[model samples]
Target: MPTPIQRVSERIAFAARTAFDRLPPEMVVSAFGVQYGHLSTAEGGDLFVTRLGWPMLDRLLPSQWYADGWYASHGSQLKGSTGNVYRVASRPAGGKSLDLVVKFSRMAQEVPLEVSTGFPDNVPPEVIANARFNSPMEEFGLVMELRGGGAAPELPRMLTQKPLAIYVPPETYQLWELGRSRSRFENHGHMLSRDQEHATKAIELDIRRMYVLVYGWIKGLDAEDAAEDAGLDAADLERLTVEVIAEMHERGFRVLDNKPKHFIVRPLRRGGGLLHREGALVYGLVDYELLQRTTEHQEAFWSRRRQIYRDLFRRRDEPSPASSATHLRPGRVFGVDYLYAETPDGGRVWTVGRNPGLFDYFLASRWHRTPRTKLSPRNEVYATRTRDGIDIVYRKSNVGVRPRADPFERRGRQIREHGYNSPFETVAIAEALRRKGIAATVPLAITRTGHHSGTARFLHDARRFRVHEPFRTPGAPAEPILIPDFDYYTLWASFGCSGQEAGATVDLETARARELLDDAEFKALAGQSRADLVALGIAGVPIANHEFLLSTDAAGRLERDARGKTRVALAMDALTAFEYQVLKEDRYQDLLRRISGQLGTLGVQKLDFSGNDVLVLLGLDGEFLAGPDGEISGTLCSFELMRGFEGLIGEPPEGVPGI
Candidate 1:
């Protein structure tokens, strides 16, 4: 990487001590744009310079790299922390140019609408979508444009605020430092007399001049944005801090190292009256190499920040005493943490948890019918928008419930991962059901084991019971039979819908239709649904197998008759033609037989190979029952049977056992 300085040898000499000393200053005097001048140095050190971008960036060419001023924060960036930030100007080119702090981690990036996961790097969108990081530094590069104005202070680490390190050229050791200032003068009674005169001097400056000039590590940045850069107001700044905490908790991150000095607040934007600085305010958490991936960061941050805030506020000389959670009120917020429940497919009933912010929301809500509840993003009308998508039980239901407990405290009581509480629990349940000669199966397990017996990520059912919510309405069903979501839980999601939302919708709708089949059309749909389910191999169900199917419809036609009266007609799609065929052809044999015969009758008939009716069947037999069988896998019963066993009365089987 060549420096912007002119003569190449001079550029190298500036970074050296010996051999290059003989070169003429003119040859060494490289003109690196306007701000950078070529010069020589002693030993070892870091170099900082700005330049225009390529065709030949060294020789400015037509490009989109026009930036007012951008800065680079020195040191390393951490996952979840607010800390000391270092800044210096970088060339105005397009590689992750953010005006605010950028986080680094394995955040799945999207190109247009395709889900692509990769490291943070500078490249065109199309190029970046397919990029990957080699190490931390490369993956964590952030270039933030400074906020407008100089009134607000930016967190050196966060706002590309640079540390003041005196660079003495090549091979020379650079010295960095820490500086302190007081607001005692301007904040009369606000600043503790750290030094009355010094504080007063700081206050004497124009209100705009009332700045705290601190000293520290890192170095240089001539970055600035003209119009949009303004500081945030004090109030808004505080809220931003809280929101930062919220994001950390929701993302399953824990801020390990935090100190007052580690925080850097920069004001690149204008002022926002008195509440907050004008432009967007950024709070960067620095020194995060010690971070852990637990959900405990909330407490750690609050405990540490409170003491720091308290000390800072008290130093202002205000006698008002206070604590944290000032923004949290009871009636305004509510939340729910899922406990444990069977999934849609009933595979692994995983036990997850609630993040800290949501925990706060749960504690703040008024008593609701559900045991627990919380305020979440409004778009959470479906799958949660958060990292864990932790659900808070707030809506009232048929289950009798009690008051919700505070999630912060409740998380302690939960099993990190519940054992038998998942869909896999069905293993035992299925065994028990099968022993009774009932046609039961573990279809989900089979679904997980692909047709070729491969592994699948959709191991758990749609509703994993990490946290199970009981029905809220007094007495309801004895068991909370969560609807199974075949699309997500089976070996399908990857090849199924686009995401959890679409997957959930399909499952819910199908489940509802299956549950509400007292009507004729629904009866047919339910029959097929059952058969389709069974053929998937969750045998031991009462529905008839696809092996035998019946079609039915309510009678009514536009036939011209003497009486000329007509009534509504009901129609049915044979359980076998669609349901049975789909399964026999697909891989769901357990599902095939289980859903047949369940269709409630209208005008019923049996179809032949050509799809013509060969016989009239009696209305459905009582719902099918699993017959006793040792080697068979699916239900062995009949729901709609040809009424006249009379037609084949002479053909008695030789193996008819005495029953």
Candidate 2:
């Protein structure tokens, strides 16, 4: 008779098979774990089903499609490190045939554990933690990314199912106990006693639970088998292996194990032939457990590609000086490394990082070909789909322009008086604000139009734009280093929302505020909340409708927090507001009075009240309430005009007090 553990495993498997049969044909599932009595399986460890495999599961496992069907016949075991694999064959509903591979990650075996001690020879603690946490999910995620065409078409498709089914047996508890003990032993080598061999054997047998993975059977022979059958020499096999590895690197992946068995070679149409008609044999890789993108590969390939594109753009824009050697590379500025490139129009593109997805999307020719919406005479904006199918907005920076009769001309004057930050400075400020927990628009890249006068014009005068800063090397006294001016264009990101789009975001001034309050209604609010409004002004920030954005769900209703208040984040253009003024001077003075007593409490000395600088977080009932800190909770988005009180010491220079 079968043991109790075996009976329980069989029962769980039967329940899963029954559930799979009832699933609708259109429903697709991915990345689900199984839960049993006092036990839970990890993602990709239990079961995974992909979109393509959803309609075909029943056809793929006819015998196991129903409760009355015979149990699946397990075939010869295949080799694997973390799991055991077996060939599974079954007949379809109408006498069709199927061939599949089923992988079983049995819990009986002790998983290898890595414990870091901060020693030089050991792996870093973070790396070990990441490996432990990501091992189960990495393979599925990588395979999905590859299948989505994020990389080359040289990888296998994943047919994973969702909500992995759990299997609980009498031995499940024992398996857990053994696995934990073995992990402890492996992590702490000194814990092993003199009878290490007996302990190892005891740990091995206690493994019980198992995860199942199913994939469509590929019709091919292993590289070794193909080589032997085709009578290929060792040199030929080695050459093929090297070529495969090179292709993988080009596609942004590195295989941790490069064994010949990991590769499969399909036979040609002509029975005996192994090569394709084009004289090149195509092969696919299997076993994605150790597949990952390395930092070295990213820098060497993607980053280098970005540099090439940048150089090409620069070269097309203007001719390089015969005497000056131009090497396309990343330049360090303000503690940030920017990837430098020149555009075809003699413009310059300085990306914020070595390899940002934004650069790859915006710099592409397709984006340039897309029609642009002119928001202003000086600001041209474009919306296009990135490679990942995300909507992103790109607007030209309006630096170096002087506009007359502008409604906010006073604010413009203040900005000019304080010194206009270059595109680089803008990006730096955006990053700094984000670090301080202030919501703001994410800055992707900076593009500067070509010097109208030509590169030679700046050759002699470039030093004038360069700022001298103190720099000391070794024991020498501080010296000034000249930093040249590389004119920049506007920054870009997914607009009207945070960098990562979760849901729809609406402009506070035009869309949301109007929907929530009528002109007269807002006027009433101005009267009722005058004190609170003034308090906001005194907080040393401006309030603007366009500077803030409210997040909403798909239904267009505002998202709420636990306390039933509307949620908001700073918009990308929020920082562009540099002047301070409320719509009325009386309101501004009232705000100044409200915050005067707490002037030292506020991080900055001066307060700027414009119609657009901050967000007044609102409750569902439309009532304003103090945030957690007993002050009106406002989302301060801009730091452009905010300045420190010279008299204060040992305090942060920005943000609302107690925020």
Candidate 3:
């Protein structure tokens, strides 16, 4: 037990951290290793404060609410129907006393029959099914959010008691006594694992433990009590209640059991009339255990927030006050600097770069749920334009899975030699190739959902686990953290979707499917692509037709010479280009042979190759420009599977299929 002097000293220390009038950012602390991983540092332990409220640390300390503090309360107000709630006033030496409502948190308990049945008829089934009780932290968090994070002053603030703090005593109780399940506790642990890297603090509840929520009391009477004292009839009370409910819903919040008793109304003079703000009844909302955002509002909020995040990301390097508007922080994983944050759905995101502002632009909520066009049938890949109008293609990573192979197949032989590369490896290889004068699709970000992979769990792939050991946790000894309990998405900039290039690119597979080329022409184009890779020193993996995207004119037409032969060329950049005119069979074969002979001298191997792997540039008139080489050139788009000299293999003409 803390002595009186020690308690006072602790409160003073806590209050010292806050500026005199300005509120500090909401923060979380861990207790007994029941960590709020996303929001807290190792130094702060087991506490969560709402950012929407002014944190009166001295008034919020446990010493002001329990044991000696309880005995010192001036008096207790009438108890509410829910039980375990008490309103009291506590005074510190030489300081004005604070009126507070302290309640035992009912988190993890089943919703009572009356409370569950009290929801509006139109309430969503999903919301009703999950409407039990909010953990002390959740209740305060929702309150803060409703208060508009205290950062935005243009919006009208919600009228509610300021959430002070959640205090979890350093004590435990039996499960039966607490009516909480250990399974729920473990579930929180899983959520912690997914978002532990987030820097914002949130409260996480534990099983078999007591949580106390402290709130600043509003000086008013419930609508029912005030109306009666003011000689208003039941009809007036009902009207007031309905108005409050509607107001809350309009603000994107709703209470499951919205009753007149939950609305606190101040009396104007000796219970004669109720107070009003600008001709509207002023009411303070209370009881937020079942508070939630309406489905429509929730969707719109996320969309708007995602847009703001992307805007921040674009100017991340520039100085601005808006940088702190969204939830983002610096994170490092697998030797790559990423802007990291948690999605509203509890998933994790890591945008590959230094700009934290760019983190929200990659959130799955922004694109994954939007209408997307399937880019491939064999792989789980799709292209979608984000709410911000940026086109991106995202694919699930097969990092920890082995490839299916048969010894007789050419592609199988290559698959046996190298496995799929992780998203980190993909971006790293892309950057490396770009530095070596290869143009590739821009690798943007990666997202890991909270759900586990159903198939990968049954398979054995030790190599990926071993290679990614260091990424299990930053600064920790290599542990096998690359387990299969997650589905990772690798996001990339869509080829030919940047400024002035939108829809001006066509992959070879699409071209062939669309009959833009005859059988002989398609075959020659595929062969030319193979020869191009050979000259560039890409070996081992068989390049696929769909992986190569060629630039086209604004009208999506290929450049043709006077003889009606398609003029195919690779544009390296502003200063370089490679032109390859359609040639006769014998001439094309000679060029292919010459390029194939240079494989050993160049010595580069790609673990995987597809149309998505390379990009061709074009001049303003859609014609291929001539580079220094004046032959063929393109950018490497997919490189997660590319390898360096150490892992290079010689070109084998016999085993590679479709080449």
Candidate 4:
């Protein structure tokens, strides 16, 4: 009765399943990312299994889901409000036998009335209202955490089912068939976002897809059944339940629908004695869909973690006993590449460039917490030499801030037009300009500060929330996933530093203020730089005097012209060793006129272009290093708002042709 295509498909599926079985399982899981393999089943299903689950993975194949010897769980507690659960026992020929507890995932479904109404009367109203079942992935992740996935002395290890795998069958069903609530599904994004700690956006549940969770079965009976078999008094069983719940609470976990039925207990071989440890009954906890941390515990945990981060920041140069290098991985955002990792305190760092060595240098604890000189009084920007002796400038990002209520201010107006660029955008723009032969500061990294921002309530800016809405960790907690509630920090290589010496680099504004260059000289250089950038098709550049950094030689002495004028050096000719600098005085009038004319011909405007954004370089003996067409050397040092305009200008030749 099968069509030819169906028959061929079945054969192909069988071959794929056979090949999957032949592949060696990867046993060791690294601390960084998920290490797993996708498995295709003969019954047209998919399985994602961890290294720990790899041993018994074959038993999880969809074809054997309902095979002989698997029976529905009929305990009193399993009879109501939970997903379809079954106990499966398999003894394969010449292989290790497996006992699995297979349950269909009930993600996105409302808590059954019976379950919701069972919450203790003392429980918070909000907790009861928001209770729902966990997705398969979430349940597994939580179970791993409970089982000491990242064990610490303070956290007590709790016995629980070993999460083997998550499987999805080939068949699909309508939402109604799965008893999914449309209202809950539609409104789930924010809640899911709140629950997850992912890098981006809120998680969404696929109502049409059925997800199943498979766990290694614990050979035990529920508390009630076990107590009946053990002939324990009611008071003893009640005391056991209370003690177990308290221990789990101390370990930062809670089950909203807590009941004795959820706990599994096993008896000893000899006299049918119950398992005990340290004068207390030992039991395994199960059914974790409603698992969560208590509020007081979560707060204390984060507070302690914040202190640890501060300590780490102070001693960054010293070898860390808990090096997080293993967790670092290659990541790219926009056009820039980064070696990124989540910090021990729950913060994240995205170190720019491809080198893994640069990752630790930009960690917030390495620089932000160090003693530093304020670089900008108006902003929380500072210049600090890291414990490793690398100079860097770090500034708090204002992506989600509104500076003033006075709508007339430049910052306010700018915020209205375009939300301040996120740290990722800032670094991406800087990197792009560098690739295009434009001189700009080196962006070191971006940090998501682990501390709660708490600044969103005072400001009216919704930009950060909207911008980061797409990057959310699924099934984290609602508090940690509120991206807008956390502050962001961006790091940049100090532009003024040359090697270990500081103050070797000075911006045009400081130079002018220090009388290194007179008023007319400064204005002329700034104007020419703006004209050159506009000619190159970049507009809206912030080129004010402070934005232009001028470099000094190793001894921190400025290069000078024959006439005793401080010279700003640009670049050196490889063949001639002659350096180029912007023309001095009215000598640049002709070149400036030409560049301005080119800007006009290209029909572009200097929106935010100013003298502060320019840089100049002088040749040997302060002589001019002119191009073939007598072009002057002018470069950009700032690109916060720089944008590439359309048309007119051709790409610069290989060497930029002396521009």
Candidate 5:
């Protein structure tokens, strides 16, 4: 450790440097097989590398190393957090000149939990062929294809089809400032234990730093609002915000995170300026890993409400209700209908949401909605019970953020045992899965519960009941739909744990699933599950000696092809992080074994889990109706399998099955 005076000097120097850059490099943090050094370079002064693991560096750098000068190689070191962030640099193999920025993250894991060194067996070939909440999607079996240097207009089109962009968030910025403040406090407080002044001073400085932008943002927008009337103007803003939200939601995308860091206020034109005051300013949102096809509106509303209260009210015990969406209905804004979609090539389309009106509306609604709270300061009330039958209220903070007084106390964050959604863990797992011959498509989207409220069981119920095959359908084939009495595949995925803390295969007990099930939607779905399963032929029988840990809840989403056939599209959404780890470990494999054993007992010697590893699997019921064509199971080949599949068939793979 540096001496007291030296430390103080270092702190001062660090602060001066960081005043300009996003990351300040004055300290060294060592972990894994590497070490990182932070300092300012002449290029873009104030920028710093917060952390860099050696093995990671060695893998990233073009050469062994160089001095404080810049180079010309393209490289980066990712912290592997939920932020798909990377401290990037471009250096020539033997030249000068470098460019650096903290790149964003679309996916992250806790390093060790899910290690995907390579592919598994032939996995699915689709974008989300076979996915797992804990394991990587078995679609990345294909090598990553990078696209750059293309004309600007094509960028958006290509991006949506097959592009991944990362971003930094305001929280990271806040955390860094928090650390700086804490350091300042500790330095002064070390000698003057009762020096509240020192701590307050540091905190005040940080608060000012963090909020200057918020205040300016609000003030600037308020000025804009002054030009319009509340009735029509407010309605217009609300409609714009909701419309933009609807477009993004329908496309199935989520922004970088909760803040302005990953986004920008840019001109609508290609030649935009910095002031954001000129023509066609819009929210140029960045980052993709956080994107999701399905996110509840309430979560987003609550998040915005929390920010409004924290920033606008400054924790002054103000009961502001306007900070959040007054609307209760879930629709377009809640789901990004305008931002993402699947392409003909099965890639992705992500640029649909980057428009001017969208950003303007986003800022307007977020800045102005500061409603008054109903409760008294230091008072508490019972949490809400939703119509979906979910009573999963865990947070205590009634502030816009938690809607309660404190979240830690009620202990609602059950699955959050490690990394705030580990991006590192997933990276490794995805890599490993690829090595194992699986085609794992990574997440462009992530889900958030009310506490992460998922209607998983309901989705299951809906799907299972949609095509329930009662025992005696007059002309049904010998093996119809999913036979409940003898054999059935528990098509599901895992959620919660991380690669760093738990292996990808950690198992979550029912207690935890119970916690996840606390979600209103799942609870209501569970209410209908028993009757549906009974109708489907599994109410009393032992198919594969297995009782569904996830008894299907009926919300009826399973879709059969429009063709006059039994062919259908099934999405198996199962497993929380805990369950994924369990499967990654002994139990999941064991569960597979138990199921297989039960199948043997049923005199069925054949089985097919032969594809890539996944949180869930999609299969067409071919046992009777042509028993899933080759495209069903054969349609999926993990990265490992995809490559090898071609060699085996001496030809490229096929496409979607049936209608």
Candidate 6:
């Protein structure tokens, strides 16, 4: 409805806004509410550009390359489906102009369910929908794998790929009416001829959206065209095609569409034959819409890779004296031993890098000799001494509980989806958090428990558990282990000052109130601790009073600052707490809403803070400077049940799971 000039002005403004940010902003707001404005196709579908792609594009193109300034002069349309392709001729600063192919993928594909399932009948509609939903990401994965040292099979080098943005057009009754009318009229003739049941579910169509990808343009012609120009016979072309297919499979990929057009062959030089001087033909494959590896293949490849990695680690570390033991195997590093044991009920145990003597003592007589503290109905905490005389805690992981009614049911469900983590996961997360400057208990070793004939029902999940293949014993059969239990060093050992003496530690709440009352500023904000607790409660986070432990020097008095003022303890029991006598009236919903909003602002989601999940550090003034916005500024000690956020590794390489 707007004039041409107005439309141009609008587009210019959009380009300016989007170009200002190096990577496109995730969302934008308009009269139609918030929408994804970045990384969309020319026809307004979803598109994604990867992190690696961004730097390459920036280096090769001008700053205004994404804007109308460069695009207007150098961008030309290329043939594609689901969305448009643009060949942008970009001239780098003082460099030659180069052509880059930018592909905008229609996010959804409507392939017949029959093709996906290989079944003519009884296919579920949801299967087709799910396939369409994952198609875009699947293609991205393939490109990423090739980029990350996977066999490329002479494919065009992918410069980078990323999700640009999601475009959801404003819903309108008119659009819905148009869709319904078209659906009915277009299928009318076919419906009249076919049976009602057959016609109803005859086709599966998805017109949802698209994503974007960028690749360095390959200089070549399609195999079909190149063969004709090069005077190659049908048999010669077929031989070349067969070679290409064999190479793709060798690299752990199976291309569903092996058409001649998808293969590109570079033109021979003048006076050169169709074949290279070395008698080899150079070609590349394209159009990876139906590319994937079978589940069995994936497991086998990863398992082999893991074994090679372990072998390398073993070779790198010096052989321990314990390696001489017949039943024991040398671990990946020195001072570590992999101890194997059989339970009384005929179950198996694989303990990682723990003292063999300590393992024997603990696993002896079904752990009956070890004393335990009942932390909760589901958790039993126990302590044991290693052969080296260092104490460690063994907490039983209650992985398979199906509670019918509980306040934490939602959180429990989320954790289950990621799998009930074993000691391996615990150690991996702890090490990762420590690297990120977050304080957490150290994981010493993992004990995998297998089910015996008389295993209890409560231990079913653990008994039937499969060890992460990477950590499994090499050459062992791929079988499920019993539940995995983790061992952790004591928290008090983390304290800097000498606090081993009795009565040298107190809860953080008591220490702060007792020591910081003299300072007016500290006294004024003393209620902040209570306020934080209220916020956490409103946010549906449950914590125990005993979790926060504060440690003092051997003098049994609060540590003093250089100015002689009392200093806060490092080992705090509770980050924040309130005295029962001064409890305030509950503002349940308001507090919950406020806490939820604050957590959302901090990008914390699907996280459970129950018990000792979070640790807060306090400054000399007795205040935790979590920032002016009261965002959570603390160490996340526990990662169990945390989801929807990046872990210490950030994004893993393609096909690799996060540790």
lDDT of all the models against the reference?
Answer: 0.25, 0.42, 0.58, 0.57, 0.25, 0.41
1-659, model 5: which lDDT tens digit per residue? 77655764465355444432243322432111122233222221211122222112222232222223222133444322343233334444345423333322112122122313232212223323322111111111010111121111122321221211111112225444332344433332332222121121111122212210000010112212322322234454444444433445433333322222333332223432323334523443333333333333334333333223223222222222444322211111111212222212112112112231221121111211222222113332112222211111111211111122133753223212110111112222233333444333331111111112223332222222222232111122222221211211010011211111012121112212324333553444443444443543334622210111221213312222476121211222222212323123443354345433433443322212331223342222211111132221111211111111111211111331110
lDDT of 4 by residue, 1-659 (tens): 98765764564454345443454433222211233445555466656675557655555555444333243422112453366876766545236557777788777787863444434323577787788776666667667766762223355577898887777776789988988877766555444433333323222346677877777887788888877668777787767766776777666677877777788898776687798888767788888888776764454344334334333433333432345455556555554566667775668777665555456657665666566877444567776756454556787877677544346876446535654556766676666555654445667778897778666466646764564454333223322222676788888765533221234555555455445667898887677656654554435745444444465555545666587555443232221121112244355544445433444544532333444334334432344445466665444433343333223222322322211
Worst 10 residues of 1 by lDDT: 490-499
- In candidate 6, position 447 carries an lDDT of 47
User: Candidate 2 residues 1-659, lDDT tens each?
Assistant: 98665764554454345444454322222221111111112211222344445445444333342113222344455654345555555455556645666554332243354433422222335544444212232344555554443344445332222211222222254545434445533332321121122111111112344334455666687677787667677787777767766666556665554556767787665556475535667576766655666544443333333334433333332323343323233554444456565444445566666553334444533244343444333235555433223334565433333222234677555544443333444455555555555444555666554444233432233321332133211122322222333344444444453243334554343332325545664344334343444443424344444334556777656766797544544432211212222223554343334443333353542234433434343322323334465654333333334444322222212331311
Cα deviation of 307, candidate 5, in Å? 32
Lowest lDDT 10-mer window, candidate 5? 211-220
- Point to the candidate with the largest TM-score: 3
- Per-residue lDDT, model 6, residue 646, is 40
Q: Mind sharing the TM-score for model 3?
A: 0.56
Q: How does residue 612 of candidate 1 score in lDDT?
A: 15
Stretches of candidate 6 off by over 4 Å are 1-55, 59-83, 91-96, 112-137, 147-210, 272-277, 294-296, 312-659
Worst 10 residues of 3 by lDDT: 34-43
Candidate 5 positional error at 440, Å: 17
TM-score of 4: 0.48
Pick by lDDT: 4 or 5, better one: 4
Please give each candidate's TM-score.
0.20, 0.36, 0.56, 0.48, 0.22, 0.35
Candidate 6 displacement at residue 611 in angstroms? 31
What is the RMSD, in Å, between candidate 5 and the native fold over all Cα?
26.5
Candidate 2, overall lDDT? 0.42
Ranking by TM-score: 3, 4, 2, 6, 5, 1
Of the two candidates 5 and 6, the one with more favorable lDDT, higher being better, is: 6
**Model 5 misplaced stretches (Cα beyond 4 Å):** 1-5, 12-219, 229-238, 244-536, 540-562, 566-659
Per-candidate count of clashing residue pairs (backbone under 3 Å): 119, 24, 18, 27, 154, 31
Q: Model 2, poorest ten-residue lDDT window?
A: 32-41
